[model samples]
Target: MSTERTTGPALVVQNLTKRFGERTAFSEVSFEVAYGEVFGFLGPNGAGKTTTVRTLGTLIAPTSGAATVAGLPLSADNGVAIRSRIAVMPESPGLYLRLSVAENLSYFAGLYELPDRRARIERALRSVGLEHRADDLCRSLSKGLRQRVGLARALLTDPQVLFLDEPTSGLDPVAAREVHDLIDALRKRGVTIFLTTHRLAEAEQLCDRVGILNTTLRMIGRPDELREQLFSKSIEIRTRAPLADPDEVFAALPGAEGWQRSEDGAYVLSVTDADTAAPAAARALVTAGADLLALTPIRHSLEDVYLQLIDTDVEAQQR
Candidate 1:
């Protein structure tokens, strides 16, 4: 999806810092959420993910720093203005048990003073595919549907940006998939989704760009960008030997790291770069008299790159 550049960023946080005495939750963090990008905010536990969002949401004042929402500077006079254009969904949006789904949605809509409120509630339920259950008590609904109602509440404002924290935490596989679908639909409609997730698959598939924040922002980019920058997006080879062992032949070749032998004694080799090393990797392995069973390039999956990014930060602190 093409994101239109905004008159200014959809959101901007500059030099954001938070501290509890000497225990700094974050230090001088800064980043921007553009007009129509689903930016994933992620980190390990206590890496200040929630702190950063709370600061931007104006739930708690930053120790020092500033943020703007939809071009309005974050100030006392405009904090309400900033919030008016944004929606914040906490990790757990425990709904009112007594209220029906429609009641719950209408309540939030009223809070935002949304016009044509009944029609908007209908649209929200339809958007999340919860129209069939719209009259059920929130407590009577399934966990996933409850979450969808929470989302529907957030959408009532038609906010330019939505901050979702662990929106699918307790759902089953099917439920998580449903929540994911909801998120994807919102992104397509050009609403910026700032999500904090332990669900790597969700982040990988849904986010256009991700910022791995430390006490400060550590790294930010599209998944592929960080993957290629931080790890080798290379290829692997697995082969069955015919007449000779691979090590005796491939051990001396340039760009070929040492080979690995599977439990069944097949050989697996790692190369520096797939495009550059594939031909040589192939020639060397084959000429070694090993039968090639599989030759596949390894792209840096989000799971792999996320570990690398988080680990790098952890190691820095350890040092």
Candidate 2:
């Protein structure tokens, strides 16, 4: 499915900071998430990711700064109105253990004061593929199933914005995939998603942009852009046979920063520019009588970029 980008950002945060007395949770965190965008919020625990979400969700107030959710200004006066336009599935499912799935959803639907509560409940359950288990008590469901039920509950209000905190945590592979599929479906419908996940793979697969927060806004951009910013281009070449002395060939290549061989015998060459260095490296290897099998640029994983950023931030703070 495709989304039209004509609409402005679904959420806008400008230097938003929140503090509790002397403790500053996060400071000057700013970003904008366009409509239909899945913006990933990532940070280590105590990094204030949750605080930022709570502030945006209107559960807590910001100390200073401004934001708008769905074009509505974020303030105490707008809290009730903002809640109506958004749904938050917190780290915990927070379902009533004794209640049936349908009952738990119905309870929240009532809180939202949604009309046609029964129809809305059914639709939400179906959205998460949990209609068959509607009558099952919440306690009886497994962790993954419980997660789905919580998701269904969040959807009952047909929220324009969704906040999911570790929505797939503790689920088996199959269940996690189910949640991922549901998230994909939501994005197709133009629902803005604010996701906080420790799973870098999931963030890489789903988020349109990511913001790293650690007591302050550290980095915010598309995953690829952040990766490129934090690391240089690299190229990997697999040879038909290992060269007698690979170091000499690699050292001769222009713009070659460093080189290493993997356990599988592929040469990983760090270069100033993969586009030009790749060809030169290939020629250098072939000239040395090494048969070439494959040559490809390497894209750093989000995890790699994230760790590097954290480390860099730590060192800077120390100095």
Candidate 3:
């Protein structure tokens, strides 16, 4: 777990597949995580997100395909080497309830055989803001604090690649925000993070890019890129009164592909480009003698893209 930086992708997966007996956990999944990038792994429950983390963490072997983790080839022989340079923080922190916070960390440090154990422990505790609670029993800590302890344990190795599985799965807003802040700080320090979570908003806010998986990778890109890929660019226009001949007005506008009246009595214009279409739409509205109340671009959230893709998968399976 040397802190020395590397020059290539922190992780590289090529057609990696895993199976349990006849059941396929995941298949033909491939992606790369760049150094210092926060790469979000998103999916619904039972979608093999954790399995993928475990496989990449060298906890389990893939059924087929290959991968490079922490700048080392993934294989039985290299498992030790790969693991030494990476850390996995599961949804549950899995601390010894009876052990004090510092004791729990010290136990794990021994497992890692990390030298300068005292200094590393201090630094890890400080990183997660748990230094003050070092002497407190883990059983007395809140769920959020325990999660921080788990994070501190993960940092004990000073991993090059950190895999986080649902880090804030059940945290309250206040606690989740604290974890979010810590993660943002880590990103600033250039720690490559592979975050798996069902929380779409968290992923959208924190991830540099995200990959949506449902047994297989459904999509992978930055939030905006995925939205543009899966949704049509559109502008929602609200007028004081409906145009008498909406079709006549919008049909003549450049960049507008089509128009529709929403159930809420607003006009939504499909466009090739919102920037180019907004001005044209405003001009068209004024010419039609309509007082425009609002002309706003429609933004699709990561949740929208996720649902659309997952729903499509469900429909395909039904067929």
Candidate 4:
């Protein structure tokens, strides 16, 4: 079954909620993923990350909300249609140990009842750079090789949207990087990917935008945007010696909102604009007759953003 291209967002979810009896899996979650964009879904364990994927994937129905997956309304009636347009690659590929790489893909192709099965299988294997291993038994392949096979299976349908749940769960750095490269390749091919992972660095590196979830939608934006939203922009100034009168030097500086001295005798200035503050601070130090060592903007990683929100939730629960 071929999936026709759709115009609008690849996925649209509005106030989506899911509850299992008394336990709420996720509540009032909403987000959209653009076609050909890699949208990262991030959260800690038991934070409804998987549940959100399962819900959006149509494996489980939402309790009270509307969603459109692959341009089709998310409903029991559209389940088959939605499944046809999207593919889900779990952490484990779940291949038969006794089956050869080609045989495993052949099995799934049969399930999808795809046409030109041989041609599709060849293309899928080639996409993941596993054409050479088609004859190798899955059990004999390394974990990383097995992962490539899983990805190949996901591509057999040429899905409009691909959901990858921890695509690099457990592997050496080398193996993990291999999978990252494949994702990069797929993104360049204009494949829309919905990636769910606990690895903040991976999300930061791969996703165009990311949503941090904790039983609810906590935040959603580009990684840098999230950092700017949650953190104040600041410039770090290191000097050969502490300023003679730090307050006097930085107090009247343009674009600087506030200043603080670090334990290691560095100065950190909260700035409205680094472009404006950096040069001004440099001249201020020279005028004060202080030896300037370094002046640079401090950058916060996505992990910092993830922890800040998740930690806030923990503190609230404690209270």
Worst 10 residues of 2 by lDDT: 1-10
60: Cα error in model 1, Å: 1.4
TM-scores, all candidates, are: 0.87, 0.88, 0.97, 0.96
lDDT (tens digit, per residue) of candidate 1 on 150-227 = 998888777788899989888899999999998989888888889998888889999999988767787889998988
Query: What is the overall TM-score of model 1 with all chains considered together?
Result: 0.87
| Candidate lDDT values, in order | 0.80, 0.87, 0.92, 0.91
Give the candidate number with the greatest lDDT: 3
The per-residue C-alpha lDDT of model 2 at residue 122 equals 84
List the candidate 4 regions with Cα displacement exceeding 4 Å: 1-3, 315-319
lDDT of 4 by residue, 9-53 (tens): 999999999999998778999899998899999987777889888
lDDT per residue for candidate 3 within 54-152, as digits (tens), equals: 999999999999999988999999998888888999999899999999999999999888899999999999999999999999999999999999999
lDDT of 1 at 284: 73
Which segments of model 1 are wrong by more than 4 Å? Answer: 1-6, 242-272, 315-319
Estimate the TM-score for candidate 4. 0.96
- Candidate 4: pairs in clash: none
